[model samples]
Target: MSRDGTGVPHSGGAAYLGMPAFPRAAETATRDDRLRANLRHATHTIRAKRARAVAELDDWARLRQAGAAIKDRTLRHLDHHLVRLEEAVTRAGGTVHWAADAAEANRIVTDLVRATGEREVVKVKSMATQEIGLNEALAEAGIRAYETDLAELIVQLGDDLPSHILVPAIHRNRGEIRDIFRDRMASWGRPAPEGLTDRPAELAEAARRHLREKFLRAKVGLSGANFMVAETGTLVVVESEGNGRMCLTLPETLISVVGIEKTVPTWRDLEVFLQLLPRSSTAERMNPYTSMWTGTADGDGPRVFHLVLLDNGRTDTLADEVGRQALRCIRCSACLNVCPVYERAGGHAYGSPYPGPIGAILTPQLRGLASPLEESLPYASSLCGACFEVCPVAIDIPEVLVHLRERVVEGGEVTIRGTRTTIKPAKRHTAERAAMRAARWTFDHPGALRRGQWILSRSRRLRPRRLPGPGRAWTDTRELPAVPAESFRDWWARTRGGTA
Candidate 1:
């Protein structure tokens, strides 16, 4: 309060910690009119455009099927393709590093940066870097990470968490962005111009000017690839802005951190995804800029190139028979744009780098259902199947969500950190388990069930509108159907005068 009058907001790139369960988070977000308006407008606009774009292609379904099939095949033989990828990259004179977890990935990147003798890095918008919290790690080692993407720059300045995957700053409108830039831009390196209005052109110009110096001076750059071709070792990055191209080409040292699942078996397999992703995510026939590079080139771009393949918790996710289908996600985020739950509840509630319907199922499996937030994520959705319909790779998100929910309620042996551990049912779910068991036993005894039903029918008037215990809150929003005065079985028997 004494230092800067404008309060310091939390960093958007910071890891999510101590987050409440999805219901609580979603409740808070629903009360926010601004958040609701922003989400409603953005999601509807993108989803509509996506529909139009997809309808333009006669073979879009075929392309989607091909994309799904390629990813599935690559996943089954991931070890072989990953090795082939490594060999191809090595042949192209690039070094490759494998990171089994987030900490290892961070350490590898930090070491590589320190080795470069540069304390600053210009970054293209890479979800992999965000997933590993690389920027924060770099700061710990006394290196500054500069975001080159305009939206990312706003997010970095605002000290906010990304509310969307593709457009990280979708939560904020232009006025909010202008305020962030005016207040925080100078602290970084450049300041917004005097009288900087919130006009799009003015904002764009200001951002361009602010980032020009960083681009020209940056010696190191880092990114995430949309797809990696195993056959040729090419990393493909598709972006609407030209910032990615600058980051890829201008830096003396280039580092790309990619998820193992991002690999496509061949360039032909790569082609299918290229067609699906742009239309699904951006609603464009093709993104304005698409960059593909095969390792380091001779005096052409980055003299030194390094590829870090990150596993993190992916192997654990792959181990889940039902949940592993999430690996097919191309991250188009069409699901997010179409999801009614996502439109209302927003992304941050998911408590992972990935959010929305994908996050609901994927995060729980990737991180395991140990934490309250992770466990609750499985039940965050209504399983309406919009996400399933919109997915480019055809991941059955609802099926996975239900599967994970079953695992949560009926906990058994779960592999945590590659070690098998038996997990007991959560204490909160024990009542539900007991109720279900009681119902099962009653169903086994027809006479007892009939008697119980008759008693309930006789005392129907005395029953409370709201149920007690765990059902209170559930009944708060929805009413239980009124019980009939007489059991249907009794009515049938009286009318027929015989056991039909």
Candidate 2:
């Protein structure tokens, strides 16, 4: 298989094209004991801390509601906020660029870096950039974009895909990280110091030393914001480490590629998220570094600032009434921590940069259910509702998953890249549809239903332990519930004399 510049198999522009469907990928992921161990440890630890952090707030529920409301209000009038933001940014000596899709966003960023005459740029951790494969695009253009965040740096050095939203290297343990640094650090730039250990501090020190040189020497920096305040043209990036601060401030030129959904109407609206995001995400009262900047400042920070307001299917996503709530995601990864499906199946199974429950809903809507991968994502969950409960913005992910499943089963009109097109129901579900139709027929006729139930009750002892043929797969890891010897109506008739 051919690989992209990033060394992962080419996923065909933003969408995970070559990857297997969710069920196939997840089946494979579940067998990896080591991967499961890593995910179990990391997710358990993070969620426990989050529980403590959330307990510190008496008004967390109210805060969550406020955050959700703020996001909804902003998304409802995104155009107005975007125009206001563009004007505010321009007034602050910043240039704004708009990108309609992933390809266009990559092209604009590549051109901007080329125009600066810089071959190397340092990057803060940004999901928007990852979604567009910005590093791979830059590599194609003969430019090197170094990841400055520790986890992101590990992923880059290891040539691995990110498995989690906040901790990209969540699937890798300390020992694995030590191996990556010891083996790959020199090729990138700085070599790991002699005999580097896997101790947390030593690993962090190695990454810091390695990234420090890039910070000082790089002429340009790239980032994505946690929040973009339209009222003041302010962009905020909250991090446990100060890498984002360095990337935001140290470079001569800074560029931010942010999704339009990240916008907030006012600074007061921004305040609601600041309070909710920390407790929900890193489980901290406040991030160690909360950097907010309003464009450029003379003789301070980056002399030149550029904000790329990227659409990239967000406008189409906003068109959806039920799924649009996913736009409220702050990329906190709280849902991933609480999700049982994510814990077992892992992030790679979803076959997109966004993963877990949010990915199940968001990826299909953003990219459309055109491929088996996208179509299968909506079925990636147990509909446990854990993700919805933990979400700071209350996105109700389970509702959207069921909604997307309906879309997959009974295809209809959908918006794709600003065009509405009709799609046919998936052929793969023919057997399922047939079974449902049979069930409907049996239920509609009272005599047939009664006879069927009586026959099932009489033959309960002779029922097969596992289903035959295609259903064997479903019964492989699950037990088929035993049927009762008596139906409820029969019991009622026998015990209570129903006619009386």
The per-model lDDT (C-alpha) reads 0.82, 0.84
- Models 1 onward score TM values of 0.85, 0.85
TM-score of 2: 0.85
- Who wins the TM-score comparison? 2
Where model 2 places Cα greater than 4 Å from the true spot, the runs are 1-15, 433-500
Error of 2 at 147 (Å): 0.5
Candidate 2 — worst ten consecutive residues by lDDT sum?
Answer: 4-13
Q: Tens digit of lDDT per residue, candidate 1, span 287-371?
A: 8999999989887899999999999878777777778899998888888887767777777777777889998887887778868
Alpha carbon lDDT at 188, candidate 2:
93
Residue 197 of model 2 has an lDDT of 94
Best by lDDT: 2
Q: Determine which window of 10 residues in candidate 1 has minimal summed lDDT.
A: 1-10
Which digits, one per residue and each the tens of the lDDT, describe model 2 over residues 1-500?
Answer: 34422223533233355888989888888877678778878887898799899879877767877888899989999999999999999999999999999899999999999999999999999999999889889989999999989998987887778889999889889999999999999999999999999999999999999989899888899999999889999999999888898999998999999999999989888778888998888999998989989989988899999999998889888888988999999999999988888887888788899999998999998888879999999889865556876789989897788777767877777889998888788878766556545554765676897786677667766867779999996545333222334554575467542221
